[model samples]
Target chain A: MSQESQPEKTQTANFEERLQNSADQIETTLRSLLTDAPRGTEQLRPPKLLAAMQHGVLNGGKRIRPFLIVEVARMLGYDQAGVLRAASALECVHCYSLIHDDLPAMDDDDLRRGKPTVHVAFDEATAILAGDSLLTLAFDILADEATHQKAEVRAALVLGLAQNAGIGGMAGGQSLDIEAEGRDRTEAEIRQMQAMKTGALLRYACEAGAILAEASAKEQAAVTRFGTIIGLAFQLADDLLDVTATSAQLGKTAGKDLQSHKATLVSLNGVDATRETLNSLILEAEETLAPFANKADVLIATARFIANRQH
Target chain B: MSQESQPEKTQTANFEERLQNSADQIETTLRSLLTDAPRGTEQLRPPKLLAAMQHGVLNGGKRIRPFLIVEVARMLGYDQAGVLRAASALECVHCYSLIHDDLPAMDDDDLRRGKPTVHVAFDEATAILAGDSLLTLAFDILADEATHQKAEVRAALVLGLAQNAGIGGMAGGQSLDIEAEGRDRTEAEIRQMQAMKTGALLRYACEAGAILAEASAKEQAAVTRFGTIIGLAFQLADDLLDVTATSAQLGKTAGKDLQSHKATLVSLNGVDATRETLNSLILEAEETLAPFANKADVLIATARFIANRQH
Candidate 1:
C-alpha cells in the first residue's frame, strides 16, 4: 500500500513543481514588462501610475491563466518565447480586471493576494488608470513583433483578446454580476454571469495556446472545449471555496459573496450537488483532451488542480 | 470690407460643414458598433452595460480625433472606409478616457458635453465597465480586417493605440495631473503632463493617418510634428476657454480647473502670453504642413480653428 501511494505522491509533487515554475517565470516576465517602457517610444512612464500598476499585478498569485497558456502550448508542440509573452499578455488582462473589481464602486475589497489592493495601496484614481494601462499594455504586448513572427497571428490574438475581455465578455459579465446582487438569480443567469466574468478569460487562455501553436481547427476546437469545461470547473470550485474556506486561507475576504447575497451554483444547488458537478466537469475536461493521450497530462492535471484547489 | 471677408467666411463655413459631416458619420458608426455584437462571436452584449457604453460614447462632442484621422489620411491620398473605421477606434479610446476621467474617484465631474456623466447617469460600476469595454472595443475594431486589409497595418494601429493610451501616455498623464492638483507645478512638468495626458492620443491620431495612408517616414514625421503642435494648441485653447467661457458655451463645467488649482500654461503664462503662444503654435503647425501645399488646406484651417475657437 505504501509503495502504491508513493507514485501518486510523486506525481502530485511534480505537478505542483511545474505550476510553481510557470508562475515564477510569468512573474519575472510581468515584472520586466511593467517596469520598462516599450522600445522606441518617447513615452515616459509616470512613476505613480507605474508603481500602482506594479502593485496591482506583481502581487503573488497562482498565475493559473498563464500556466494554462504555457502548458497547453507546450502540449501542442509550440514552445517559444512568444508563448510566454502571449501568456503574460493574458495575465495582464486578468490582473487589470482584478484591480477594477476591487475598486470602491465594485467589490470594495481592500486586500487581494494577502496585500492591500491597488486602490488601498495607492489611490482610486491611480488604481483606475493603472488598470487601464495594464489593459492597454496587454494589446501592446500581443501586437508586438516579439509576440509572433506572423502579423496575422498577432492580429488574430488581438481580436480574440479584445472580444473576450471587452463589452460582451469579461466586462459584460462583471456588469451582470453587479446587477445580480441583492436579487435572486436564475441558475442560467448565474451561470452566464460566471462564464463571462471568469470563464471567458480562461477559455481564451487555452484558445491563445492553440493560436500560438498554429493548431489545426480540430485540435483548436478540442483544446477550446477542454478550456470551457475547466472554466466551469474552476468557477464551481471557487464557489465551493467561498462557502467553505476562510479569509486567511483564501488571502481575500471569503464568504463576502454570501453576505452580498451573490448568487452562485453552490447557493442554488446544495453543496453535494455542486461537488458532484465539479467532479463530472473534471471528467469531461479529461475526456476532451483524451486524443492527445500523454501529451495532455499536464493540462489534465491542471484541470484537477483547479477543481480541487483550496484557494 | 464685407466683400474682402466673403471668401474667408465661405472657407470657414466649408470647414465647419466638413467637420460636422465627419462628426455625424462618426456618431452613426459608433452607434452601430455599440448596438450590435461583433460578427462570429458567441458573446452577448449585456443590455445595461451596452446602454451605458452608448451613452458615454454617443454624447455629442467635436469628434476632433476622428476628424484628424480622416482628414490627414485624405490629405495623404488614401481615403477609404478603413480610415473612418480607424477613426472610430481612436474615438472609442478618447471617449473611454473621458468616461474614466469623470468618475468620482477621478475628476468627479457631474456633467459632460451638457449631459450627465456616465457615472452620474449610470452607476459608477457600470460606468467603469463601460469605459473598459469601449477601450477594449477600440483594439477589436483596429484588429479586424475591415479596419485594414493588411495585417501589418492593423497590428501597427493596435500597438500605436496601446502605447499612446497606456501608462506612459494618457493614463499616465492623468495620474500626473491628479497628483499635481492643489500643488504648484513647473512649466516643464505641466507641459510633460499635458503631453502625456492629452498630447499622446492627438499625436497618435495624426500618426495613424500616416500609417493608414502608408506615407513615407519623412511625411509621417511631418504629420506627427503637425499633430504635436496642434495638440498643444488644442490644450491651450481649452485652458483659455476654461478661464474665459461659461459652462453654457463650453457644455461642461468651467473655471473648475482654477477652483481645483490645476496647473496649466494659461495659468502660468497669463492669457496674453498664452494667446501669443497659441498663435505661434498655429504658425508652426501650418509650416509643418507646407510641403503638402493646398492639399493640407483643410488641416491648416483645422489648426487655426482649434486655436481660435471660443469653446
Candidate 2:
C-alpha cells in the first residue's frame, strides 16, 4: 500500500474501534432496559411482547444514532447515567422505526440486518406492537429520573424526541416518501423530505446532548448544524451504496431505490454529483465543530465515517 | 313516562349535558394544537400529516377519555390548563389506537364514527403515519411546560402515559387480542387482555387526574380502581354493543367480535351474564368514588354512561 493510504487506513480503523465501543455500551444498556420484564403481580407487559421487542432491537446493527448521542453528550461534559439512558432511548426509537418501516404495508421488507424482519420473525400484529412499545418506551426512559435529574431537561428531551420522530419529522417524511413514489420530485422537495425522515432524529441526537449539558442556545444550534450536515451525508452515502454495494454488504436489499422509484439525492443528481455533494457536506460538518477544536475530533471522525461507510 | 323513571330520566339528561360540554372543550383544544403550523423556517410537520391527525382526532367521538380526565380532576379541586392538556394527550393516544386497529391488517374496518376510516379517507400509509404522529404528539403535549407548572408533574405524567400506553399496557393487550383470535381463552385470560388493552388508558386517565391534583396515594389508588372498573365495564358494553347494536347505530361494523373470533367477555360468558357483570362493576366503580361523595357524581354518571351507551 502507498504511504499516504496508511494514515487514512489508520484513521478509519480508529474510528471503527470507537464506533464499536459505543455500540457495545449501547447494546448492554438497551438489553437491560428492554428485558426488565414485569416482576410479581406486574403482568401488563407480557412475555411475548418483550420477546418481540428484543427481536427487533437486539438484532445486530451499528447503533449509530445512540453512538452520536453518547459522543456528543460526552464532548459536552454530560457523561452521566442519564446521558447513557437517553442514548439508549434514542436507539429504541430508531429500532422501532426500522421495524415499522419494514412492515408489509410500508416497505414490505422481509429481511433487516441480514436476518428476518420483525414482522417476518414474529407476526405482523406482534411486529406493530413491538414498534409501538419501543416508541413509547423511548419517552418513558426520557421522562424517568434515571434519564435526567432535572425535570426541565427530561421534558426538553421528551419534547425534542416527540417532535423529531412525529409527523413533521420521521413519520411525515415517510408519508412523503410513499407519496413521492412513481412521481418526479424536485431536488428541494426531496431534500425537505430527507431532512424530516432521516435528518430530524439525527439532529435530535446532537440537540439532546446539548439539552443534557444545559449548553447555551448558540452551542446547541452549532451542534445541530453539525448533525444536519452529517445526516444529509449519511443519506447520500446510503444512496450511493444502493447503486454500488451488494445486499450482503448492506444486510438488506440493495438497489431498492430504483425498483421502488424512491426519490433520493443520487437519483436526482447521479452518483458522481452525489459523491461530490457528500464530500462537501462532510467538510461543512467538520467546520461546524471547529469551535470545539480537537475536542470534536471524534465527532469529525464520525462525520467522515458516516459519509464513507460501506454499510 | 312512569313516575319512577322521571328522576332517572332527569339524571341521565344532566349527565349527557355535562359530557357534551367536556367534549366541546376537548375538541377545541385538539383543533388548535393540531393546526398550530410551524413558524419561520421550521417545516418538519407537513400539512398533510396534520390533516390526517385532525381527521383521526376531530371526528365526532364523545371524547369520553378526556371528559373523564376533566371531571375527575375537577372533583379533586384541580382544574387547570394542565389538566385539559393532559386530557388531550390521553385522547390522542386513544384516537391513534382506533386508527391503527381499523387498519386492514387488524380489524379491517372501513368506517369509524360514521365516516371513512383514515386508511380509506387518505391511504394506508397516511393512516399509519397519522397514528404514529398522534402517539408521539401525546408525549409532546405532556412534556411541555404549559401542560404542568411543575416539572416533576410533567415528568410523572410522561412516565404514566408511557407506562399505560406501552407494551405492558395498551400495545401488549392489543397483541394478546390479535393472538387470541380463533383461539379459546379462559375468562381470566380474556379479562386480563381487556384490562391491558382498554383498561390501562382509562386507568391512566383517572390516575392523571389524581396526579394533576397532587392527590394522596390512597386517593389516587381509589380513582385508579374506579377507572379500572369502568374500563372493564366499557369493554363489556362494547362487547354487548357488538352483539346487540346495529352497524348504523355504532358507526362501525357490529358483530366484529364474533366474526373475528375475538375472545371477548361477552363471548366467554353469555350476554345476560355479561350485562349482570357490568352492573356489578358499575356499582363497584361508584363505591370506589364514594370518598369524594357528591363531588364524584359526574364520574358516577360516567360509569353509568359506560354501562348503558346503546352504541
Please tell me which predicted candidate would have the highest DockQ against the true structure.
1
Q: Which residue pairs show backbone clashes in model 1?
A: none
* Candidate 1 chain B minimal-lDDT segment of 10 residues: B34-43
Score residue B308 of candidate 1 by CA lDDT: 92
Return the lDDT, model 1, position A70.
92
Residue-by-residue lDDT tens digits, candidate 2, A1-311: 55476998888887898899888888888898887575221356787778889999987689888888888888887788778899999999999999889998888999998889998998877887788889999998998888889999998899889988888688888888887788889999989988988998998898899999998888898999998987898888988999999999999899999888877789888999988888899889878999998989999999988988988
Each candidate's DockQ score against the native complex?
A: 0.77, 0.59
lDDT of 1 at A98: 95
Number of the predicted model whose TM-score against the real structure is largest = 1
TM-scores of chain A across candidates: 0.97, 0.96
* lDDT of candidate 2 over B90-157, digit per residue (tens): 99999999988888878788999899999899877788889888999899889888988898888888
| lDDT per residue as tens, model 1, B1-311 | 36466988888888999999999999988887887664444378899989999999998789999999999999999998989899999999999999999999998999998899999999999999999999999999999999889999999999999999988788888888998888899999999999988999999999999999999999999999998998899899999999999999998888988988888899889999999999999889988999999999999999989999987
In terms of docking quality, how is candidate 1 classified? medium
The residue pairs that clash in candidate 2, if any, are A44-B168, A45-B168, A168-B44, A168-B45
